[model samples]
Every structure is written in structure tokens, then in C-alpha cells.
Target: MKIIPQLLFVIAIVIFGYFFSKRVIRIRKNIQIGRKEDRSDQPAKRFRNMLLIAFGQKKMFKKPLPAVLHLFIYVGFLVINLEVLEFIIDGLLGTHRIFAPYLGGFYTFCLNFFEFLALAVVISCLVFLFRRNILKIPRFWQREMTSWPRLDANLILIIEILLMAAIFTMNATDQILQTRGAGYTATGRFFLSAQLIPLFEGASTAQLILGERVAWWAHIIGILGFAVYVTYSKHLHIFMAFPNTYYGNLNAPGQMWNMPEITNEVKIMLGAAGAEQNQVEAPARFGAKDVADLSRFNIMNAYACTECGRCTAECPANITGKKLSPRKIMMDVRDRVEEIGSSNSDEDGKSLLGDYITKEEIFACTSCNACVEACPVNIDPLSIILQLRRYTAMEESSSPADWNNMFSNIETNFAPWKFAASDRFNWSKE
Candidate 1:
């Protein structure tokens, strides 16, 4: 029945809305549980950053081959979704090609363009799958990649391919039905899908209609399912990248964000004028031990991570086979956040610093900022690493002996070297 299809479409819409909202609320709650810090400064610069880094994907061009392939997939996915809008309208009204009569030739042009992009998506996905599974790119096979991450990546690519195939099938069958005078709208020929016509030739009108309906439902349902799955996948970066880039650190790479209390303490110790008046109280804890102690941006950084391995690949510590993997750091944070979100209590006697990330990995970092520089979405894993290191040294007093000695010298003298400030120019005298 015509009404039956519309009824099914409405039920599917309601189901998608419910699950999508549930995941969004959980994510929002998890992100909000972290410490708050203002990142609203310089609206103009942030907007430009979002456009270039997130939308234009400027940072992905470091490696040209994968960059071009990724561009095809990314641009294709975004552009071809324009057809989904029409699909939605048609499903709701129980009509076929609702926009065909209204837009006429333009509708045909749009479908042709979508088909071209769909083909591009299929090609790009295949290349990526080959690179990941066959070529065995080292980054894709990292320690943190594990089973789920690898499978998630492969699944997303396969799904994209199948969804694109469904579109071609639907269009090809629709064109056949139109020619057969089965009350189908004549939207002219689609360039890419028209080539697929031969595949469905010699089939009866009933069979053709069945094929089109199946593809029609599959494509839309696949999209809805994808929207929900992304929240739980590393593909969350698809949406989070925009906001992450917009609020990315605008300060110089070398200029670390100091603790406010530490800054105030330093000024007071230096006896700067009015320093006592501006003195701030110390925080309950020195640095982050859990996700709750981290800032909202840090949690968001975890969520925004593409798990692309660029951060770990560029990390000097990881390159030298130290325990630190910047990608893992982000993944650990996200996992911990998810654990906290799902549990009854935020405290589980297991903290992020000790349980998820180890002291070895934290201490292995060279503080070189390579990971920060390499992240496409501007996620600063070094920031989280430093926070964990701070907790180890300040709260736990567990810094290595070599670092302790350096800290003692800095406290007494003016530098890491064990010499007086007044004799700092003695090297020049020698």
C-alpha cells in the first residue's frame, strides 16, 4: 500500500531521532563533565581556522597521494548527500522523483553530478581499503589500532561503497521503469547510473520495481545508521573536526598554557608589585588524574581524534620506540570518558594517569611538539601528556631522579644548570 511505505518511513525517522539524540546527549554530558576553560577568544581567527583546516582540509595535504584520495571520499560524501534530501521528501510523500518535475533538467544535472561523486567515493574507498589491508601501511597497524579500530575503519569504507552501489541500482532501475511506462517519472538519463542500465535489462516491471524499492530503502537506512555509528567511531572526527579546529589553540607552539594558580604563585614569589593582591588560591589537585580533571577541550580533543596515526607517526618518542603513542593517549582519554559516562560513579578507583596511560609513556615524551604539529584537526596530545606528567611530579612526587635534580637546580639557580644567576655569563668569560 502507498500509505504503508509512508508509515514505515515515519517510523524509521522516529527511531533514528531517538537513538541519535541519546548518543548526542551522552557525548555532551561526557564532554561537559571535564573542567571548563574559556576558548571563545578571537572569533574571526577561529572561523578562518574552521574553514581552512576542517572544511578545506588544508592539513591533510602533507602526503599528496592519500590526501587526494581522502579529498575525493570526503568531498564526495558531503556532496552526494544532497540526493538524500530528495530521498527523504519522496519517502514522506509516497511519491517518486518529487523534485524531477519541478527542477526538470536541473534535477538530471544534479543526479549526474551525484553519480560522478558516488563513483569517486567508490574508487577512493577501494584505494584506502587496499592501502590498509593489502599494502599494510605501518600506521594502520599500530599497537593502538587493535581489532575494533581496524574493523571500524574497514566497515566504514565498505558501508560507503555499498551505499553508493545502492544509489546506482536505484537510479538504473528507476530509469528502466520510466521507459517501460510503469508510472515512473521521466527525469532524463543519469550519466553514471545510465551505464548500469544493462545490468537490470530483461527483468520484468515487478522485479525492477522491487529492486528499486529495496535500494531506495537500503540507501536511506544506511545513511541513518551511519549517522548514529559515527558517534561511537573514530569517524566522529567527521563532525567534531569543525568545532575542534574552531577552538584550537591559537598561541605559539612553544608557548604552553600555564596553570593560573602556578602563574600567580610565581608572581608572588618574585615579589612583583601588587602580586599579593592578585594572589590566587591553589587548586585541590596539581594536574589531571582523570577525565574530570581535564579541560573540556582536552576531552573534545579525544573525541575529535581521527585515530589517523599522524600524531603518533610524527612523535619523536614513538619514532624511537619509547612507550608513548600520541594516538593512544587520545584514545585512552576517550575510552576513560566513555567508561565514566556509562558507570554509576565517576570514580572507579582507576584513574586515567595510572590505569589508561602509564608513567613510562608520559615520561618518554621529548616535549618536541611534533605530535601537536602533525595533528590534522589541531589536537594537542602534548597538553594532556604534560598534565599527567604534572600530576606524577607534583601530586605523587614520583618524577625520575634526573628530573628531580634538574627541578632542584631550577629552584635554587635560574636554570636547569647548577649555577648561580649572576654567573650565567661565565661561559662567555671562559
Candidate 2:
């Protein structure tokens, strides 16, 4: 009994250490990549919007079934930690049912309920995997041309499978133990391990003990490994996602991206003529030139992406065969940031507009906010694209010929179309 506690403690510590070290390293690297100004310090509306989207998981509901399934999985994982604690106690202290007396009948009922919910989560995840792998869902296709290691995808699959296997196995083993006269003690009282007893009829005591030990170890190992993997993989969302969602920008879907203002004196000193010039030349300023230009929250967004490809799936640019996937754009930004920080190179030499993201890619965007509305993590790719547009239009005097003509017409005739100013109020029939 004493040995079990020590073993569990050591495993926990090792898992914690792995995650802590990885998190610290990633944070430091992210900081080195740089940060954009804090827009989160804005008004109360922003906070409210972030809360509704992030906490509410509002965007995820675009794919209602998958979203609902994930919601259950997420909540179940969090609530089941209490049962996990009991499992540890059972293993170490030799107490079969550790949580029975505390919450009584009600708690047991909930435990049984969530266990069924977890089974649903497993089924849903399998469906998702099959859709991605066998069905070749267009949404899951790689939008980036660059090569990625298959190992990354395989590792994620393996981890998820292990986690589900552990959950099901643990439940089945506990059911067997309960049926074999391991009365409803403090922990096992609320859980219906009794359902599993019928399956193990005629099994010897030795077989039952071995089964329990196997299930207990599987559960512990799977959970601990999952914790460690969360920090290192794209699954970092499992931990950082909630906080990222909690601190997200909460505003109307299509709100324009704002550029910070520069005082007149600074503008004059830099020989800048207007808001556009001021934005380009301002020190510690405008468009993202390096990783450091991204806000910490944006960096966290990169880590939080589930690679569900919902953003790309909804992007008009991607559908039209343009070299832009809103999904890949986020990924590219992260990659460029890392490149800039590690190499100490200037990304400003590369054009923010054009072939890098492509002119068609920009124009293809209807600014409809479909991608933004679809993203589960609240990544506003439209805002990033607009920032690039602003830099090109203001600093370089570069824009699509059609858009430039429209701007010229708007300035000269006071109308976006080629119409006479006197005709503006023609609706007032005399």
C-alpha cells in the first residue's frame, strides 16, 4: 500500500516536471519572438465579447454535432479528476470505494452519468479520425505546401487512443472489483462498477486482482503522459486554450483593426505626411515585421489551434485555389516569427502583400467574417490580413489598380461609383 502511493507520487512529479519545463521554454521562446501592443487593456465590451466566445465555446457550434461532442469530452475530463483522485487512494490505501460517503447517492449517479458521456466522446473522436483519414475530408487537407512530418500526426492519434482506452479499461475493471464484494466504500459508492461484475463470472480472486492492477496502472500512465504531451504538442490547447479564450477580444465580428496613433511631432520628425505614413515609419510600430511584433495572446493562439482546418475550410481564398489558407496564414506567421527571432533577421524586406499571401488571396476575402465566425479558438485571421493591407496601401502607395481607381473616384467625385456629385440627392423627386 505504501509503495503504491510513492509510485503514484513519483509518476506525478515526473509528469509535472516534463510539462513545467516545456511550458517555460515555449513561453520564453514566444517572448523572444516579440509581442504586439496590449489591446486587451481596452474597454469593457472587449472583455465581454471574449468571455462570450471563449467561455461559451460559441464559435465551435458551427459544426454542432462535433462541437457538442467535444464539449462533453472537455467537461467530463475536468469533472472526472475527482474520481481519478479516488482511484489513486484505492490503489495506495487499499480502500475499494473512496468517495461513497461524501456526496452519497447523488454523486454516484453523476459519476455513472459522466462515464457514459466519456464513452460518447470516444465514439465521436473515432468518427472524427475516420473522417479525416479514410473519408479524406477536404477541410482536413494540408493547405501548406511545406512538408510536415507524419510522425506529428501519428503521435497525436496514438495519445488520444491511449487516453480513451485507459478510461474504458479503468471503468470495466472497477465494475468487476465492485461486483466481487468490494462493497461501496468512500470512493466506489457513487460509481456503478457493479455493471461490470457480470462479465467476470467464475474468474478467480487472483485474476480479479491482476485485472485491477492493470487497469489502475493504465489509467495513471495514460493521464500523466497526456498531461506531459499537452505542453509539447499542438494539444497545448488542452491547458492554454481556456485562458486564451477567457482573455480573447470580445467585439462585433467584423470590427476593423485599429492602428495606434502617433503624435504630430513624432510624425513631423519622421517626415511622414498622414496617418498612413506615421504608421509605417513609427519606431516599435505598425505591421508585424518579426515575432516580437505579435502579441503574447496571438502567440498563444498559434499553440491553441486544433488543426481542425475549419478556418481554411471556410476561407473563400482557399476554395478559389488561391495560395492562402487562413489556417496556414496563422501557421506561417508563427513560423516566420520563430525564424526572425532565432536568426535576428529583418522580415520587413519581404512584402507583406503580394505572392507571400497573394493579391487574389486578399481580394478573395469578402470580409464576410465566415472564418472568424468558424474558428473554435477565436483567431481573427481577417484582422491580420487587413493589417497587411493597411501597410501596403499607406506606406508603399501600392494597391490593386481597380481598388486604386475606386479610391480616386471616391476622393474626386465624392462617390465610389463614377457618378456626378449633383446626382447624389436625385432621390428627392421634385
* Winning candidate number (TM-score): 1
Query: lDDT for model 2, on a 0 to 1 scale?
Result: 0.64
lDDT tens digits, residue span 262-311, model 1: 87777778876666675677887998899899999999999999899998
> Lowest-scoring 10 consecutive residues by lDDT in candidate 1?
271-280
Residue 33, model 2: Cα distance from true site in angstroms = 3.6
Instruction: Evaluate model 1: give its TM-score.
Output: 0.97
- Give each model a TM-score: 0.97, 0.75
Give the lowest summed-lDDT range of ten residues in model 2: 183-192
Candidate 2: which stretches are off by over 4 Å? Answer: 28-32, 40-51, 87-97, 101-107, 145-158, 178-204, 251-255, 261-281, 336-366, 390-430
264-315 per-residue lDDT for model 2 (tens digits): 5565777677635444435554654334555666666766666677888887
Off by over 4 Å in 1: 267-272, 419-423
True-vs-predicted CA distance for residue 138, candidate 1, Å: 0.4
